[model samples]
Target: MTTNTTPPIPMDALRTLPTPELGMLLLERLGKETRFLPQNITAEARIAFKGESDEADLLDRVCEAWAWVESKALVSQVGTKTSDFRRVTTDGRKLVADPSALVRLAAADRLAGPMHPALEGHVRTNFHLGQYEIACFAAMKEVEVAVRDTAGLGHSEIGVNLMRTAFKPHNNGAGGGPLADAGAEGGEQVAMAALFAGAIGVFKNPTSHRTVTFDDPMEAAEVIQLADLLLRLVEKAKVREIKTENE
Candidate 1:
């Protein structure tokens, strides 16, 4: 005789459930039993999700989701291992009151502080929805705007040219501005200019001029963090105002 094991959760539905939402769901069930186990949560989820979903399909997903919440400190564990667990944590309770709190907390951790206040809304909202490419695009756009506003450039100047003007090392005809001053040496200035310029040219420009799709949140988050770093550099950049004889 053969015994069948529970199958994995459906990837489609699992992906649809963001981590915070998953945590919230677990909190609802685990509330009934103050002290719980993975199997208990799994059984509860299977029953709740039945008819709407396959019973065998929910076990692994519920377990995986709960483990993540526990690891994140949103849920605490009791006895030794997965066999015994605890309910919602202080952090988890905060999320229950305000679902969006998880996104803010995550953004803070991912960014090591508040992301540029300007960029936070876009990053948090779309990121939770799995819209990684849009989040990255919006972030780079903030960098572009910051560079433009700092440089006193017009709308006509964009992409590579804008970055080149704002940060390129001072030369005979054209003098580099704030970004140039931010760098230690002339070469470093040029490189710094190129870094932001390249980021905008390669990432921002494409997204602005067309649609770009990114499937992996990790990859998109990397780019968003890069944009964050660039924005931070801009924030620290020293603007040198050149005064002519007229002034």
Candidate 2:
């Protein structure tokens, strides 16, 4: 659904300095003895080297490196917005001196919560940049694709109608089948059908058609998790159990 396959590393910079050397420079920029002021770092990073590189491009690489280390809590921003400064933590210095002290900072978790493995390729990539709506939409598209495949439906069957057709409960007079266990009491089947169909209608459609704001990553995570739950249910769909009888 989303083609965000860009690896979060600058290859050329890594080749030139390696992660350790680059990490140490970041530490130096952040100050080993004293805190580095935000203004000074920006000014220093923008100075071009021997006319071989652009200042802005170099600044971006430097900032990208810092963001990875900062996310790992190795560097902390001091003071309020007006008077911001950065200081390398003791752990940060350890990583600077010995980059192998721990696993790579770039390889660490991007968010506080665990991202579903299913979402890693597309959905979570968008989420990494606070693009919550895009992540939610990608996640829902994943659910739609999963349901479509599970139902043996063509691309023609889409959105809510596809969901309804696939999961519509068979009341002994149906042309289609249930998407979940047609339970002994029949209520579970009915509820499952409604849940899946409703989820596609409510969660998938709006995000697919419009720009729905999901302000926070927590909110986006919850929505993506909702799709995760529904997709797991779709995985349970099978033709043999499409018409289970009450026992």
Candidate that would win on lDDT: 1
Lowest summed-lDDT stretch of 10 residues in model 2?
1-10
Q: Give the best candidate by TM-score.
A: 1
Candidate 2 on 31-51: residue-level lDDT in tens?
555666655654544443313
Q: Clashing residue pairs in candidate 2, if any? A: none
Clashing pairs in 1: none
Score candidate 1 by TM-score against the native: 0.57
Per-model tally of clashing residue pairs: 0, 0
Name the runs in model 2 displaced over 4 angstroms. 1-117, 172-178, 238-247
Cand. 2 Cα-lDDT: 0.65
